[model samples]
Target chain A: MSNNPIGNVWIYIEQDGGAIAPVSLELVCKARELARELKVRTEGVVLGSEIPESLIATLHAYGCDHVFVADDAALKLFSPVPYQKVIVGLAEAHRPNIFLFGATVVGRSLAPRVASRLQAGLTADCTALRIDEFEDKASKRVLKNKLMQIRPAFGGNIIATIVNSWQDPQMVTVREGVMALAEPEEGRKGTVTPVPVALAPEDTAVTIVERFKQPSEVNLKGAQIIVSGGYGVGSKENFRLVYELAETLGAAVGASRAAVDAGWIDHDHQVGQTGVTVRPRCYIACGISGSVQHRAGMSESAKIIAINSDANAPIFSIADYGIVGDLNVVLPKMIRAYRARV
Target chain B: MSLSILVFAKQVPDTANITGQAMKEDGTVNRAALPAIFNPEDLNALELALELRERYGGKVAVCTMGPPAAANILRRALYMGADETILLTDRRFAGADTLATSYALACAARKYGSCDLILCGRQAIDGDTAQVGPQLAEKLDLPQITYVESVEWVRKGRIRAKAQIDGGYEIIEAPTPILLTVLASSNAPRPVGAKRLMQYKKAVTRSELSARHGGRDYEDANLLAAEEEGLRARGLWIYEWGVDDLEADARHFGLAGSPTKVKQIESVVLTGSGTKDVPPTDEGIRDLVHELIEDHILS
Candidate 1:
């Protein structure tokens, strides 16, 4: 509980091979919205073996007031210890009021360790965040300008709004694609502070034996059309119909949590809050009874079509066209009809 | 090289099977209606730890922090060939968030003495936070590898494993005294052997045995010691530890140490106005396809 905050909201900028992740910018934009409410500046902290000049420029364009950077060969790949050292060191000295991270693989691994080192409170996979006043009736007082972190909890339709009133530098890792990515201001400017990286042999114990990048895999976000299946898809053999339809439509295949849990398909295709958040141009859901968490991911698609045997499935609520029939009978009709029309 | 490994497990409400009765009028989960099961990913973690013990000839102990009923997972661990089991149960450790949960777990873990490695699932299904394993590593001051797919080996004071990254994967090498969070896709966990199950069915924690004694505990110290001795002599005693056993500060144990508080639980209301219900027919399918084509959604 330190009252000596630097009056700035800081975001940890994640980069891979000199390219900044889009979630970093989304958080910066969100931080700007939060910072304005608190009357503070939004800044960024980037650590890479090589920080590109364009990456810094992009941060300023996205509304960061300052960018703190530490570049070194030992810090090239993302490791828990070295990354924690850099972020925790900067946080200890600057003492920002709020810190944010992207809910990516790198962000999830690093944020918890940093929070533990600082003894700060951290909320993971936050879908919505805001600044509000808290009425602590038990203590007979009101705490003003607290960060309200909202996320889905206990895996039902339950949504929990969390607050970190007991800890300073309230932290969260924002979900990808949840916040809107604002258009960059192009030529905006900000100040940059270069931090020196001091490392010992103990800090560099882990070495990257190999890194394999697969760019041609299942990319749900970039797809224009998606053919998704759910638990009702039944056996792994029945899932072949979904792949066949996706092939006919030339679209990527998606899955509900049930299909993935049943081991019918790879988890990369899961479309929901726990998985990937996607907004394709057209999303065709088959045998999927959409939960609130599932809807939170793909409800924003340009158009949605749901096919379920149960007429009362929640997926139909947001679907543009709802088919109350078996997908086994309907998916083939959809594929054949589309082929005949083309 | 024999290694000492501790695997962290949790019993979570089966979120996949949420029924209408599971939700209350205020939108909070009616937790009692949901069935609790061993967390799926933690089984993967246990499998990994067991695999290590098979190769390295070390001890694998399973620990879980929850209600007295969480002892169920510890017994299951024994059935799956775990050498030891510990149930960290205390009434004061209720309503703990991830940070306080990790703090109590770290204190409980030290009771097993220093171990070469620690393992747990990437995240629990109930919260999906994935914060405890790494937070525990930070508390223990050990390097951690998260989202691990496979452990190549843990020999000669160093560990090598392949961890899943964003797009693909990366292989890294780290020193001993490390922690790894296992993913679900790692391997198939072995089932409980019938022989082990038949033998260890009598294994009971202090709370469980007391419940069987008409909910009465041994008030005499010698009687309690003799009871424990009889169970241990028959290889049926499961270790149980409370807050005092860990020497944890009262303020840092449960809800007191939790920094984050749930402010509110928002109710969900469906609000889609223009959902067109299509009939199941050939014309209905063809018409929908034509509309999508005309809208430039399809080629």
Candidate 2:
């Protein structure tokens, strides 16, 4: 074995407005898996204004062996320039073989910049990852240590396997809910390595003059129940049925890409490859004929309940429970029944 | 001052609809069976670049990384008013994911040299991996604006663009020599001009000429010289560059240089069953909806 110690796999824990993003935990779980496979430790890199110690302990319970904390007032709000400079600085000092990130809006912006500066290869939106060992026919030797990053390619038609041979730290961004969240281990202990960030006023190229946070109705990713609509809903006005049902169940409203593209719903509610990838416990997909693009995002749901007028719709294939009927007529009566039951 | 803009486009296989022998058993796409067309979003990007060139009295060049046959789109670009076209084709570029692909493109961009702006589609239809533009920007160390819906302002040293986000749009201002990833909603690409189409119809790529030569040479020195002279007269020659031509580091050029690896592929076909076909009557609908609600399929 080489004398150099294998680098730890680090998760860039993302928090906004003093609340941790659900995707951060997802990356922690994924990094734990990679660390176990490679026999390396898992670390969480948290950057914020002043993160609470409780949050740092929570990261430890989530399988992080160490938490690198960089609490700077400049990091209160995400400014790409300062954040990138700090993250790149940390990465340069302590090199990690693999860096796992959540492919959120902020991550999407920062990952590319960091990868470019590090001169490393980054595969975005990876669905799965594993360690592969193989024997080379020509060399007559076994190649035991390799990171295999599997992701949907050609619009999720074929799963392409990408290998970064030249870059030191191979990186990948995972979509939310793609990996199972580890059970928080209470009383777990880990060291907190505090890194100081010297962010100057000149480092900030862009300034956030104003930040408008959309009112929290129901976060689709964190929602236990989701009521979704699709193209079969017909018109934008008819989307009210989906909202009504979701409201009745106290669930979040989701939409297939077709419905979002049709202007029937907002893009944030879109549940597909390009939009938000969701895996709700109980997903009520109304009028959605599950296309590959739609399924690539939500096939991991615990239980799917599909309702469509067409009995042969593909959504039924993945659904644990399915109903064949027009959503317009079925939704109102269903709402009445739910009101009676509750 | 006349500005110069470069638009990067790629001809990817139409993997969206593959069926009935369109894909060989070896998993390679059958190019002949699949229709070759300009990537829809890339065309929108090309249109935005062309509009910029037209509005500012500048030159537009369209560059592509694909096989020799990709010249079809370059010719179309020429007809659309791109002043020049370059094709970066080499066998070594095969099996390139986004990282390798971007490195090759950055090399090509350097070859073009000293452009005021660079434009690319937000993502390719086939890969749908929006990494290339950002990755290219990183490699070139230039300011990048992604998902741009409109070019609000463009002057000599600066450009302000509007990019779409989750709820609203953000206006970003970057200096010139920047990259913009144009969203499909940005603008409708204009149709080819008839006059320009007629003028550049005779355009032929280098691969096409080499194919025409057929390994035979004219016997007389005069005839050989004449053929070379005739080829030059037609403007059919295209500058083809190899890996060495770009002076790219061999360590970071191809599949061997990439770090990510694919382990396995499993085709998942979800299977389940539940059916309810109620009458259009209100009573029947009520009964069906009650069942749906009871099963938690509705609310």
Candidate 3:
């Protein structure tokens, strides 16, 4: 262990084009909970090219006790080698009890390298996190302060809770929208520690050739309300009803894997075990039977409403409100009412 | 130059329609009842491997670490056009999490001799951890690109790939001797070719031969040995390697080395305020919409 005592729960602040990603803020919020349970400080580690003070302030607002900044020209773009070098450096110098990363492309690639180099145990794509005590089955020896990493297993058929009791800086990469973001405390104050990042020539072996952001790619994570359809929607052309409901509600359109597999929608719009997990405030399911796989993704929503032809559809079991009817007949009337109200 | 590509695959329990019997009492999946299928994404990885082999002359070898029953996927891989198949099976290799699993795979990869590339699915549907591919790369000390969507080009010992990012896509270039974890949407996997299926349908692993011939001792199974040798000579045999064959440290073989402990597993059921039924009529729809607006469900 380093001479500096380890305690802080660190969040790797992910940013792109100099703007912080929402997932980073969400992780900071999560780290605050872990820190409170462990009685430790919550720190945000930001590595980029001249990160703004406003970004540092945002970290504080989101519950970070301190912000570690390693701003350099070499760190401008997200490269695996250089980012890992700097992160591993920080982890080595000031050992942290827990390191939380948003399971984005950058985090997923970098966490394993850091964990491997450190020989630390990491659980990826966790949906829930908590502090729990672990006991050996045979000897009954107990270990304290274990991070209980809860995630879906066997394609969302079950939830497996994993614990890495041995490794220091217990690492976890959480799904982007699984954790709810904490409200920011504006004017919140925190310390900023500037760290040195020296990049070696060999650290740039893998380079980015080009990056293209397609506006057409669907992102259901940030949607306040989601209007999702399943095979019950009937046909690809009938998918219009789902979209129309979403339009009236000013929400994103999501589809179950069955709809996508049936070629009723693009893969980008899929929400389920093989697709993206979403945690919108309100989710309206139209003609979905709610398979366990589909529920794995959207069960976290604050409220769910199901509309289906069958009253016994599984979606209705989890729904706060159920409408037993053909969505084509019911959605048109709902859309008309919403239009009148607006 | 024929590029040697190694593909890591797994046979997973079909979790599409789960029952109470899907999981056993020990917080482990009950594999006996669940039908095992070639992990869907691994098929995409295999497809990428085959496509690369076709474009730039190379040999593709598919490997999986599972029970003897997993040889089914090896046969499937062969049917799909893999030049070779290796089964890394051993009783001691059971109950491995990502860490130990990757260690055993890395050991087998080293014993397989020189490899220019390694490919795997982004994550197995069963484990859903997505750590093995990257952890395997780290254990092998190779550069890796995960979430790969396309292999653009490979020339002069360097490779370029298009991969999905947070918002869009990124083109990444890395040197050879790298590992890539392909995404599910990367490519449409090809079906089994009739000719390749006929040629590889007789392929069997040594353990399979031992089991079929009703002899635990390898030396006593004379007919099985001869038939295996005949298939081996004809290049229709799947390579079988145990822990001893790979010279893997006993400590790192399976559950002993895994740091993760599954504390509990629960079948999640979402509970809401009991659902209220709304009629199919227009007035019912209108009242429901008004109620939703009043309850702050819809704005």
Candidate 4:
């Protein structure tokens, strides 16, 4: 171990259009757990322009010991090249044993680049993490610095345990909702470490000509309730029932990869190994025969309700509640009852 | 000017679905039980390289880092119009992760002298680790364009490519002698040509033929005679390369050089049960919806 003491476990807070992504705070909770086990502090790494001071404190309430702000004009939008260079430089200068990033589009692109530059081992889309302890008899030393990074491998059929044996800092990207959220605290206080990054014109290889945010139709990752459709919904038109129920309950509409491939829904709303992994309070699946790929994404949902015509649908296996019925008929009545209740 | 494109491919065990008593008692994959095939995406990458070679008029070299069994893919590469093939097979290259594999491949690539372009699949299905291409670029000090959805232009010195981004795609320009990790959307690999398959059917590697004979007992005279007759008959002959041929760093070639290790494997079986059949009636729907809302499944 280097004489320079490791300061704090930092969580790179992610935000899109001024709203904090739920995964950012989810990472804070996970980092908090890790810090407790290691007897270290937890910090939040936030980068952007015009971020409110109040938002910095919000991170503290979520268990951040210090909020490191790297506000800059170039970071106003998400771009891999500049973001990676800055984070990698910071990580190299101030080494952190374990860096956690959300397994979003941006994180996936940036993590690998940073990992390559730092020559660190990075496990992607990890579902779990823990610290292990061991003693080296020959050296008369206690080897207590092992971070076991766990993620689903072989198309989600097997869970692989990956370790960064050489590098001082081990990195892993976690999918949203894999860990529980911490209770919010009031009047939390933490120091803010302001770091300055200089951006050059040549630093960014690809440029975004325009930024378009389509009228956000229910961000499924942040949705408290979700109504998802699957292949068993049968036809594209049958998806109307899923949307109707979602509309009635004010829930976001999600779909299995099969439905997305069938073009019944867009890829953004897909929930599976290749799609978004959601951990909403409630997730209702209509006509989805759950495969390991699909389950890998949403099996962690707080409450799962599967509605399938088949009695032996795999979705029923993990569902908190199972409804054996044709989704076409079951969805309509559920929508009506939800409307009536409201 | 003709383009010489080099494509890197791997033969991975088909891990699409694991079942039966195929998995070993130690929880490791039983390679013998699993059918090995040319990785689908790598085939796609090879197809793209072949298409470029055809359009621009140049030679194609296909290479792989595996055991002698990997010669199957090299022969198929020849059937697909690759001018030459190289197999970087050595007992030292076993159980390599993406990092160590890239190191060995980069060494072999350097020995291939200089090439105009190199192409590889974004990731292998078995490992699903998309690190080799980028890591190779780092080692070779070449410009890398990953997630390449399509190639707009491949000129003499510069190449224009489009990479898939989150919302859409970004078109970027990089100088030649660059590396690209082809996406699945690039193009479908063409089936083997009947003529080429028939012509190269007898092609064998030195190791393969030696193994067939239980040793290298066949006299050099007999082998030379067979090669001459086979070439005259169907243009078929073996291509061989020893470790010294590539001049790779012996220490950095395989498992011993690899830093990553698989500690344990666990099979997580997810099981649950729920409501299965609902009547197609108004009241039946009402009850279902009520339960969903009460359970916060709909709200």
Alpha-carbon shift of residue A238 in model 2 (angstroms):
6.3
- Give the lowest summed-lDDT range of ten residues in model 4 chain A: A133-142
Query: What is candidate 1's lDDT per residue for A272-301, written digit by digit as tens?
Result: 877778889999999999887778778899
User: What are the per-model DockQ values?
Assistant: 0.73, 0.28, 0.58, 0.33
TM-score of each: 0.96, 0.83, 0.91, 0.80
* CAPRI level of candidate 2: acceptable
Fnat values, candidates in order: 0.84, 0.31, 0.72, 0.39
Model 1 error, position A336 (Å): 1.9
lDDT against the true structure, each candidate: 0.87, 0.75, 0.85, 0.75
- Candidate order by lDDT, decreasing, is 1, 3, 2, 4
Cα lDDT of model 1 by residue, B48-139, tens digit = 99999999999998999999988888888889888888888898888888889999989988877899999999999888889999999988
Deviation (Å) of A295 in candidate 1:
0.8
Model 4 alpha-carbon drift over 4 Å, by segment: A1-25, A41-89, A134-142, A180-218, A229-251, A258-265, A286-293, A307-314, A323-342, B15-32, B217-248, B270-287, B293-296
Q: After superposition, how far is residue A137 of candidate 3 from its true place, in Å?
A: 2.6
lDDT of 2 by residue, B1-299 (tens): 67789999888666555554775564444557776767767888899988887778788888888877888888888887777888888778766667778889899999889898899988787766677887787788676777878887688688877776544566776677888888878888889899888877767665565456663543444654575567557554455666777869866666654544454554444455443334545566566557656766555
Which of 1 and 4 is the better model by TM-score? 1
Model 1 spans with C-alpha error above 4 angstroms: A1-6, B20-28, B219-221, B271-273, B297-299
Q: Identify the leading candidate in terms of DockQ.
A: 1
lDDT of 4 at A213: 46
Judging by lDDT against the true structure, name the best candidate.
1
Q: State the lDDT at A64 in candidate 4.
A: 89
Tens-place lDDT per residue, model 4, A45-150, is 8877778888887898989887778888788776656777688778877788778888765666566666767767677677778988534333455557567887
